[model samples]
Target chain A: MESQQATQVVLASRPATARASLENFRVETTPLPVPGAGQVLLRVDTLSLDPYMRGRMNDARSYAKPAGIGEPMPGESVATVLESHSAEFVPGDVVLAQTGWRSHVAMDAAGLKKLDVDGIEASAYLGVLGMPGFTAWSGLEVIGKPKAGETLVVGAATGPVGSLVGQLAKLAGLRAVGIAGGPKKCAYLIDVLGFDAAIDHRSPNFAQELEAACPNGIDVYFENIGGAVWNAVLPLLNQYARVPVCGLMVQQSGTLQHDTSADYLAATMRAVLTRSLQIRGYINYEFTEQYFDSFLREVGTFLREGKIKHLEDVTVGLENAPQALLNMIDGRNFGKVLVQVRSNASASRS
Target chain B: MESQQATQVVLASRPATARASLENFRVETTPLPVPGAGQVLLRVDTLSLDPYMRGRMNDARSYAKPAGIGEPMPGESVATVLESHSAEFVPGDVVLAQTGWRSHVAMDAAGLKKLDVDGIEASAYLGVLGMPGFTAWSGLEVIGKPKAGETLVVGAATGPVGSLVGQLAKLAGLRAVGIAGGPKKCAYLIDVLGFDAAIDHRSPNFAQELEAACPNGIDVYFENIGGAVWNAVLPLLNQYARVPVCGLMVQQSGTLQHDTSADYLAATMRAVLTRSLQIRGYINYEFTEQYFDSFLREVGTFLREGKIKHLEDVTVGLENAPQALLNMIDGRNFGKVLVQVRSNASASRS
Candidate 1:
């Protein structure tokens, strides 16, 4: 299984503006390096593509260092160890690594997380049981603070974080409302994930649809797709509503809307003052040290019990990873977007 | 002394837009009413001219009902009991009441808070130890959550709420930065109030100066001014910063700034996610039931010990209340704006 050449997608150029295109990325082939002392040679199984990668691609002052040009685009993936020099792991063992958009890599054993692929699929660790799932849990429980009978609204409802958020809010006895791009995702939110109401953000009357759905007003709003959805969320937010701003997937296309009218800014500021709204932004790792184990225990159990459901939109090969990411950012993907590097046999999940 | 007639400022008309004017309020003379059973007739001493009055002047959807036309403008004041029909109060007793901008009023005994005016001046109850003080305490302690050595920035630094917030943050061992309107107020913040840094919002180099002052970045931003000040603040906010949204005084003047450029709102939203910033908006009353007693005890002690300082910009008549409020909203008044209805005899405060 150890091929001489390893394939990876590298950032060929930075975007001229917020929007990135296929030309900005290049599929490069490099000779796979052999494992050194305390290192492992791993073949990528599945790679997780998320919105934050957009921020990293640009040279700006951000939470983390920008993804460099001519380097493999930053990402995390589930992989299979082909050869190991560390005592903790052996060949055939699946693990998690920050391998970026790569098909094969040599990584120090210190950075790898051994995956327990007992009853769970390997790719599940790339999303539902990994960073996206942890993000949903931490933001909702720690920031959104979903309470029984409270109404919680999340954007990108079919995506990993939003889907898990809506489901968890429902399990906590909240009125879970979802905002998605199309009729199918909206249907999936209500029928598959048990969302109380689902509104299409792409609809002409999206704002009105959202308002009509949340008659009592929104208590907790999980902000992921910024701009129009945020404008709609502002007025409908209840007094003391908590907004856990997780990601801004739509912002990359310059779709971030703001103060279109004088009243929008005034009303938002006034509401923040009068209604006591709480708008917080965060990354997942902040709560990892404190809440990760509890999250794993709780959400892991829900997944095993079939109480929480997740969807995956897979693209085969490392070359298609860039297009899949662009589609995900454009709200064209139906669910969590993943690049399956190897074969369909490893993609099976209950 | 009981009067045969009373002078009160009433809402003549709601503002056509966000900006309220002198014409919107009218000073009217009417016959004084006798105290009914379980009620007291009170003579207003100091009328608190708060920024919230600007909000009540509008007919828009808000936290409370709009000030009714031809009715006394809503407010809280320190008044002397002139006539009483209840066993709880008698003539000469000073108390706190929701008396509006009136020289005299007939209020139910149940609605009055009997003042324990001893070493503390009665006018201090209208500013430092009253609602403004409570607003400062609750927003800073409950929401801002200031940690020692962290930097705290506040707009309207010379006003009642902001002044107290800065002082409290200082006492808690945090570095305090104040944003005020002019050189005079800026000097007062650093010289009199002990603010580590003071930047005049009116300065040509205001934003640059503010960024330079908070070299470590702002951990807590007490949002009250909401406009150019907010624009200057967004980028300077540190990761995990807590913003207590108490008021938007400058917003009434239509000074509320928004995404003037595409990157403004994008940068703000992105920072909220990456830095894990918390922007919470609230009115003082929400925490009344839970934290009021603590506020009064803590702030009362601070005021008595000379640990907290406050300033007042006073107008001599109830007729002047409208202009004073307008001035406060426009950032023209230097300190906590108050309408001195009667005389300077009751104006003495430590």
Candidate 2:
């Protein structure tokens, strides 16, 4: 395996703002590592591009460590185990690994989860069956706890996390209101994803539209976009509403000023005192150990039975990863952004 | 009963700022009514003043209805049952009721809670065993989940809710850091109440003092006073910290200017997303049914064993109720603000 070469993207510098240029990344070739005892050597098939990766570029303290300068960009990936010295895994087995922004990686079998893509695609393990899906599931079920006849509002409604969140709410017998940038995505949410209503945040009457859609008031607001959408949703949240803070995609460039957050916080506090609002924040990793089995069972069943549906915005090849990531942060990708490094001939059509 | 006159306070008008004058309240006398079936007529003995009442004075929609003009001030109070037509209670029985700012009230027996003073003072029910105590227990135990070795910070350190919160956190094996208005209260928090450290918010070096106190970073910021105290506590909170939105006492009178509540909210949302914070808002009523028995047992045991010691700022007579309430909101009350309308010989010496 030392003769085989691996392609990797390294963080060249810290980004000052959202206009993160590719000059901050350098693709390098390294000798593919051999599997040590209890470790597996894997060929990466697809790397997941998420909004959280943008935070890693900055030298700020986050839930996870910021990717230091010159380190490989960290991310989750779906890969095939090429060779393994561990009893748990074998060659030709598809698995999920933290191979990060690379075409190949060698890691202990303990950290890598075996992906059972029997009738499902391996890339789905990176999105709906992976972190993004679990984020939606945990935030909604554990935090939001949206009940039947209640309202749930989620921004970036067409993205992997938000789309699944809205769908799950609808399935839970609640009114799902989706907020997306364009009229097309809004239309896609209502027409295809079965959300009760879709509010186009790009529209001049975005706040008004959101107010109109959430007639019963927003009982559960999955706060993923914390900028203008937050301002819009603030007044409409019902008494005792639940706000599960999932992401802050809109504040990537620091465009949204911080002055408005405190009033909302005061109002939210007042609401909590009066209405008993519960706003809890969680990363999927917290629940991974406890809820992994149940999440895989429930969400996996939902996907296989077509009870839940997800769209993909595939960015083909390792070279397009940086651009794909940029697009993801900018809301350019319509769904889960997947960087397809290698493909199986049989699974290509799907 | 129809000939009996009841003195009450009405909302004369709304104030523009924090310096609410006596003109804001109009004192008037109205005829008392007789109790019908399943009802009790009560002579008020004490009224509990809480920060939430400040929100009701404003025209904003909250968990409860705003105080209407020409209506008596709303509050929970301890009273002697003067007359009753229900089998649930008899005349001379002491009980707690939401009788507002008045000398007497006619309430449904079902609406009143029988006050079992047994070995404790009646006013203690309004502070420790009542709403404020429940607020602390429910918010801290259910939301904050203060663990051993973790630090818990709370503002308005000498007040009923905050004082109990600190004591409770200490009992749970967590270090308690308190924030109070002046040096005297800070002294009480440290020397008397046994808080690990107390920062005087009114001091010139408040922010620095707060930062210096919490070496481990605050694991539970039991937020009540949402102003400079929150500003100081925000950046110091550890990852995965819990913030129970209990009150916004700092913003009660609307005198705050150039206040960074918006920035705090944005930061809170970002913290929630990146750090996975659990910021929950709770009303004591929501948790009463579920935890009341356990609270009575726990808090009752603490009080009997002298594990918790508290001070009472007793305002003797109903005539002083208005000023007492105003003082409590202005941080003039050093401890639990209890308006004593009637005397009990067993009252503990202050």
Candidate 3:
């Protein structure tokens, strides 16, 4: 049999601002990598595109290392083991691997987690049953500390993390109020996702709508998108309110250039002092060691029971990843964004 | 028997900025209050002047009601019960009361906490054993979470709260670094208070000195005074650092007029996200229900064993309280500022 060719997208350039464009990525084809001893050759099935990828594009000090120029843009994917040289993984085995924006990868078996997709879809592991889902669960449980009857406010409501956060809050007996960009996302938050109230952040009277949604002030704010959403939520935060900050979607594009007249830092600190507020910033992986298994059990049960719902926006082919990522960052994608790298015949095999 | 008059200091005006002048205060003579049913007539011995009072002076919404125009400025005082109409106290009994800036007061017995001053001085309750001490204890324990061998940094080192915080950190087996305004105060922090290192904020190489002191990077920052000191400490903060923000001394005087052109607010949030930091703001009273008893027992013993030391800048008369408070706010007062409202004749009875 002739050797197969693999397509990979590499970071061509870093965006000067937070706004990323397709021009920043370059798609190239190379020979499929051969599996070495103790390694498995993966055929990428579904690639997860997240907002955090924006931070990795820039050469800045962050939780993770920057995606180097001329290298594949780093990402997690649900892949099928096309060939195996390891005792752990066999051919046709579906697994979770950090395969980046590539069609095929030869990686050590130790790096791949074999997936047991008996009753669940393989792509679900990339969204609701995966990192994004774990983010919502840990941040809410550990930092947000949802108490029954309290109101919870989350931004980017239709996204994987935000939607799951609202559902979890509702299950925990909290009043879940979601803030989304458009009327459609807002409608989905309230009608489909079971949020108590939904406010369109793009509305002219956003602050007023947010206040109306949360009759009682926000007790826990699941902060993902910062900037105007944070500004609106600051005054509405009740005494001893907890804010579990996971992502700042707005600032991920670049450093904010705000009007100089306001001293927002001083005002924020003042609120923290007077209201006894707790603001904790975190990344989900920090809790993986302690809480990952618990997350899988709890959230998996919720998903299996039809208690929590999720949505996905898929772009066909690995070459469309740059556009998919840009769309997700700009809030054009309504849910968890994924790049379908190949047909799921191998992933569906028992 | 001749009726005695009481001299009281009242809030004459609110400061337009953070700078409060003596003109904002007025001294008045009123008839000594007569104890009513379930009441106590107390002669104030030492009045505690704290930083929180500046926030109360503003008419803005906060945790507590703002000080009303022409009302005696709210404060905590250690007093001698000259007469009692309740079963809880009798003549010559020392107590803690919310008697404001008055030399004498008639208050309900429900509000007064009877003190058992054995080896500790009665005035000690107004400083090291009182609100400031509790502020340090509760903020450190509840928010700072100082672990053994971690580095703890505190501002206003010679003040009641900072001094106690450093001492407590040392006791907890953490490296304690203190920041103060002048050479004398910095010297006192290292020599008298047992801080591992002291950095003078007045020095031109303040940030460099702070970086030198905390070789391991700051793990916990007891933030009471916010301004240049906070700016210096921010860059040196380690990942997952905890900041218990009790006060913003510079902002309390007025809005911070910074020389930097960049948006500090955006920078701060970015740091919070990148570093996974925990920033919490609280007042001591918030922890009074839970941690106050633990603080009194632990710190009270530490004082007895000479494990911790305290200093007081006592002004002679009640008339000088306005000046004393101004001095404290301006960083001119060396330690905890207090007003000797009356003779210790009744206090010496214990």
Candidate 4:
């Protein structure tokens, strides 16, 4: 194998506030790692940038450990194997790996899943056919349990997770209503994604707008953006409403603004009791073993048949990953944010 | 049959504050109600006074309607059929009825459930074998899902619902930890009811005590009391913990004092997300059709075989119900609060 250079991004410092900046990340050019016994060396093609990375930057308690200072930031990526040491694969095999923000990585063969992309784009595995899509599927199918004609509301509706959640809700015969930051995303949610209604959460009368959209009250609120959006959605939730808490993008900045006058905790608890609400928080991996296969098959078929549509806001080169992630955190990204570590032109085309 | 007068207590006024005083209730002697066609006249044997009735006193939105002014305060009671106009029940049959805070009531036979004593106390139908028992059973079985050896925590440890919840958790092979307002109730929780540990919420180090008690962390929290107790239990909850919100006894007063320094709602939601928590709110009636039979059969057997014990703080007279209910709201009652409207000697022996 050629001794190539790999560009990697690492966490330089923890963010001082709720929002992280590009300064907190450091880019470095390092020698490409070699595959050891039972390992595979891969060149990352597309790196998925997600909101959960914000939590990984903080040195606080969370479901996953914080990214260490000077260490490569954790992430999932679609890659092509440059070399292999196990019977599972050989050179030129396309696979999924947790290769972080690096152009190249040496990963255990057991941790890599070889892709079966016959007529599908390899980059699709990092978005609609991957973790974000699985998160939407499991949280909605298992937790949301959207019944026919029930109003389902989701925030960040133009993003990968929220987009798929709304689509799945619509497929299950639900009245899909979406809440996005601006009119542009809202318009896309209605026109492109085929949601029943879209409310611009940035509007001054967001709560009223949400109420107007969900005339029957929200039966399943896929909670992605917390803070004001959640407050607006709370009062509109109907009896026996299910809230699958997937993300809290608004609160990730750690400087959340809340109503000081009212006891929101008591009010929330009271609402939960009186309305018989189910508020469940989950990470996708919890259901991966049981539901990932079904999710891939169903969502994969939907993608191929044009029943579902996905958009990607791609940033070229591994060095731009920090800015891409920052853009995602600020809701500037119109769709699933991806950092192109290697040009897809060099990889086998579908 | 002799025409006898009956005594009834009615809601005189709505309380302006969190605490309800005697002035809000009035006792009066009225002519006995006669059973119309398809109705049975019942002589109230024991009236069950519960925390939920506190919510009914306020003219607020809830799952059930508020108790009407100048009308009997709504409650569940064990009664004897003094006159039966329908074939479903015969005279002298003891049955469970929503007879409210009245000594005698005329009700539809269809609404009454005839008691099957068979070595069980008829009054037990109003306490351990009735609503409170069913509330504990259904919430734990359906929502809590107490797996063997999981740590279960409950507040209001000596009350009807909390007591039964702890006992049931123990029966389900869980390590039960309880929280109560004082030392005596806490003692009762540990020594009498067989909880693994009991913490006094009144203690200055209540949170610390709870943490010490739940060494393995709380996996299933049977939330009957909300407020300070909930605050302490929140941080101690384990990952993937299930909290079944059956009641909020502490918030019943409607004047809950909470800490202002922290954004508790955001913190709670953050915890919910990071820990993958499941917080579900439900009223017992929701699960009645699905799990009530299993609850009765199992808990009934436990009661008969000395596997479970119950305590009743009985007020012997129809007129004393208001004061008894007030005592219960103040946490002065150590067990299930009940008003004995008629003596056992006057009623047919079961």
Error of 1 at B339 (Å): 4.7
lDDT string, candidate 3, B1-350, tens digits: 22399999999999987677889999999999999999999999899998778878899986589999999999999998888999988897999999999999999999998887888888889888998899999999999999999999998778889999999999999999998877888888888888999988778898899999999999999998786677788888888999999988777544333444666767777778778999999988989999889999999999888888999889979899999998877767877888998855533554
In model 2, residue pairs whose N, Cα or C atoms come closer than 3 Å (at least 3 residues apart or on different chains), thus clashing, are: A260-B262, A261-B262, A262-B261, A262-B262, A263-B262
Q: What is the C-alpha lDDT profile of model 4 across A1-350, one tens digit per residue?
A: 34378889999999998878989999998888888999988988889998779889999996589999999999999998888899999988999989888989998999888898876888899888998899999999999998998999998888899999999999889999988877788889989999999988768887888899888999999998888778888898998999999888777554335565667888889889989999999999999999999998998888888899999999998888898888877767887888888855554352
Q: How many backbone clashes does every candidate have?
A: 1, 5, 4, 2
Task: For residues B1-350, write the lDDT of model 2, one tens digit per residue.
Answer: 22367777888887677566677788887888677888889888788887767777888876689999889889889988888898988877989899998878888998888877776778878988888888888889888988999999998788888999999999989999998876788889999999999988777787788888988899999988776677677788888999988787666545332265346667667777767777777777777888998998898889878899878888876666778878877777777788876545323321
Q: Which scores higher on lDDT, 2 or 4?
A: 4
TM-score to true structure, per model = 0.82, 0.85, 0.85, 0.89
Candidate 2 docking DockQ: 0.50
Q: Let me know the DockQ for model 1.
A: 0.47
Label model 4 with its docking quality class.
medium
lDDT (CA) per prediction: 0.86, 0.82, 0.88, 0.88
Candidate 1, B149-213: lDDT as tens digits: 99999988888888999999999999999998778888999999999999987678888999999
Q: Residue B84: error of model 1 in Å?
A: 6.6
lDDT of 2 by residue, A120-174 (tens): 8888998998888999999898888879999999987898899999999999999
Ranking by TM-score: 4, 3, 2, 1
Residue ranges of candidate 2 with Cα displaced over 4 Å: A1-41, A51-75, A82-84, A100-107, A254-275, A319-331, A343-350, B1-76, B80-93, B98-109, B254-264, B319-331, B343-350
Residue-level lDDT for A297 in candidate 2: 90
| Candidate 3 C-alpha error for residue B308, in Å | 1.1
Each prediction's DockQ against the real complex? 0.47, 0.50, 0.58, 0.63
TM-score of chain A of 3: 0.89
